[model samples]
Target: MTQNIRVVVVGGGYAGVMAANRLTQRDDVAVTLINPRPDFVHRIRLHQLVGGTGDAVVGYRDILADRVALVVDTASRIDTTGRTVALANGAAVGYDYLIYAVGSGSADPSVPGAAEYAHTMASLEEAQRLRSVLDTTPTTAMVTVVGAGATGIEVAAELAAEGRAVTLVCGKVLHPYLHPRTRRRFAKRLAKLGVSIIDGPDARVTGVSRDAVRLADGRELPSTVTIWTAGFSVPDLAARSGLTTDAAGRLLTDETLTSIDDDRIVAAGDSAAPSNLPLRMSCQAANPLGAHAADTVLARITGGQPTTIAIGFFGQCVSLGHGAATVQLASKNDIAKAFAVGGFLGAKIKRDSFPGLIEHLAHEAHQPGSYTWKFRDDTRRQRLQTLAER
Candidate 1:
């Protein structure tokens, strides 16, 4: 009898879970997924969690494959040479092949007192903590949200719709990734909810205190609760484990998503820097990467050649509260296009997508090889070829 292949996946986000489920295609493969939290966090709905609009957690049993083992522990280090992962609780998990999908979290705020006072909503605990804080805060108190990315916009709109005195401090242009027309549409919706929009270079946060936040323009806003959604920072597991990593600390892999140092180690999701040209860090990109990573590992296990990754994006959907949303159309390469969708239709699509995403995961759990995605991006292909020529 042939020995079964043990593939250990780190991180239980979309990428890790999908990869684990897809690996169940072969009875000879055993998948073990290790996550810090026992439950899965619907990361796109984190803003809803913070604003009391929705819960952002799902039990792993609801979405994870029964054949896959779920380990709830933080990965402290990866012993690449020994093919083992060190856990925070002083345990070691050995594997025949390892998948690195350790996703990202809100970047630690360097603004004075921001880290100590301002709250983040990147994880379950953080969102719960922020929700608790907001619960105790008086409605009359000012809620200041820093950053104007998709997260910040959603957060600001969600709170403002709930009658909070919300001010969105855009470090620069509002919805920088959206086309100018879509940005205007979002601005109109936010205004309708009485959200105060403060954009421009001078709107950047310079400092944060218990009851106030200072701006770059020398104005201090009376902010009872400050929220930061500025940027993302990936866990340093790959770098600390002596693996080859890019400047941003993501594991460096070839086009096949295999590690440069070890063929048995594969990478995907936000923490994967394949060819040092990673896709945008979002669930949109992660799902396909997860499927592709499992394909790579399965190919190697079967003594077959793995194909290069070819991922693309549709666009971005930003929820503007329960009543409204905006879908920014984009090309496969993620450039915001001129046409956009807004209003009730947009909100409906956004509402259906979360449950739809969970159903996709559950479907894959029940039937391993059933889920497949459309993948063909001539733009991405041309860009990679150009990079190679240089």
Candidate 2:
């Protein structure tokens, strides 16, 4: 009888869960997933949760494979030498191979008073807490949303559509990821919905207070509730455990997604910086990365050469209130193209994309190595060349 390979996947987010499900295809492998939450947090819809239009959660039973065991506990330290992972609850799990996919959260030590006074919708718990605060805040009170990214825009538009006073303060640029024409379209729609957009020098936030947000230009905006969606930072489990990592604490991996320090350890999602060329932090990329990471591990176990990453990206989709959205098209390499879709049709596309993501994960669970994506031929060749040089 062949000895079974034991694989322990950390973090239950999209990347971790997808890798676990994909690994279940091999009968000779035993898969275990460790996550702090019992239910999967639809992180992409977290803005909607804060906006009160979505629940932002789904039970793991809906997507996880039956063969994969789920453990509801936080990972504390990783002992690569011993091939063991210690949980926050004082439990240790051993693994022949490990997948590190702890996703990102609101960057810590954020602007002063931001953590103490401002609200964030990065995680399920944070969104729930912010929703509670929003329910109690007066409708006429000023709500300042700092950041002009998709998260901030969605939150401001949702609240403004509901007749709440909203102001979006863009630090320097607004919708840096979108083309100028698309940005203008979004600006017009937001303005029509009564969301005031503050950009340029006067828009830079210097500090956050209980009742207002101070600007770098000595201007202050009165705010009853402040929402911060500025940036994201990954957990430090890899760095704390003495694994090779980037400045942001994301694990460092080669082109095959295997850790530089140990071949038995692999990484995926926002927590992985492969070849120091990390993919954009989005669910669109996370799913593919997870699948690819699992393939690398399986290849190693079977004495086969691991495949290098050749991932491409689609555009960004942002929800602007209930019946409006913007789907910015992207080039094969993921540069925002000038063309975009907005209005009700765009909203429909956005809604369909959400359910499509979950279904894709389920399909992978049922048929491993079945979820495949496309990339331009030239882009694929270029990526392969880059990996060869590495």
Candidate 3:
């Protein structure tokens, strides 16, 4: 009789949960999922939570496969050579394969006083805290949002829709990823919603105080609440675990999603840096990468033919103030294209896509093997050639 394969997945986010669910479907494999929290945070809904538009949590029992064992402990250290994962509670678990899906965190604020005063919507707890603060605070309170990325825009718009005075501070113009036409549409919507877009001279946040945000050009914007959605940075666990990682602490993996230094270890989600194709830290890439990582592990274990994973982004969606949105279509390579939709239609598209993605993930978890697609060898070859030239 063949020995049962043991797969340990760290982190309960989208990638880890998906991987564990898929792995549990195989009777020959025993899967253990480790996470600090019992509930799975719908991280994508964090901005909505902060804006008091949605609940930012889902139970693990609702999504985790019945056959998979849920370990409620934080992964303190990974011993790849020993194939053991050390938990914070001093329990060590051994595994035949390990999946590291520990996602990234909100980037550290480099600006003086920003870290001390600014609240982030990176996690469920932080979002809830921000929401609580917003709910209890007076309606006339001034809120300042630092950054003009998708998260920043969404949060600012949501707050503005709630009749709060929101000032969006962007180092550059808002929605740089969007086409000029879309940007103008968003700007107009924000303006109509009474949200102030402070670009150029007032863009940079030099300091954050209890009552205001100091700009780089010596302008003090009165703000009772300062929210930071600037950027993200992966955890340092990858680098500390002796894994080959990029400067940002993302694990360096090959086309197969296996770490370049260790085939037994695989990485996905925000923490994976696959070859020259560094995917962004979003649900768009996380779900696909989770499936790819599971497939890679299954291929190696079952002695099946090896396959490379390729990712192709569909488009970008940014939600403006209530019932408004901007959808920027992109090529498979993620280049911005001419096709775009905005306003109510775009909002509908954004809202519809969430449930669709959830259903797709549920389907993939239930039937893992059926989702495999032929590897794009042409794209792989092109990526390799580009690397060589570099």
* lDDT string, candidate 3, 221-246, tens digits: 99999999898887787777788898
Error of 2 at 280 (Å): 0.6
- Which residue pairs clash in candidate 3? none
lDDT of 2 by residue, 298-368 (tens): 99989999988878776899988887788998976789999998877799989998898899888888888
**Which window of 10 residues has the lowest lDDT sum in candidate 1?**
373-382
**Weakest lDDT window of 10 consecutive positions for candidate 2:** 375-384
Indicate which candidate wins on lDDT. Answer: 1
Off by over 4 Å in 2: 1-3, 376-390
What value of lDDT does candidate 3 attain over all alpha carbons?
Answer: 0.82
lDDT against the true structure, each candidate: 0.90, 0.89, 0.82
Backbone clash numbers for all candidates listed:
0, 0, 0
**Residue 376: error of model 1 in Å?**
3.2
Candidate 2: C-alpha RMSD to true structure equals 2.0
Angstrom error at residue 16, model 2: 1.0
How good is model 3 by TM-score? 0.94
lDDT per residue, candidate 1, 287-355, as tens digits? 889889999999999999999987877789999977678889888888899988886788888888899
Model 2's TM-score against the true structure:
0.96
Error of 1 at 100 (Å): 0.7
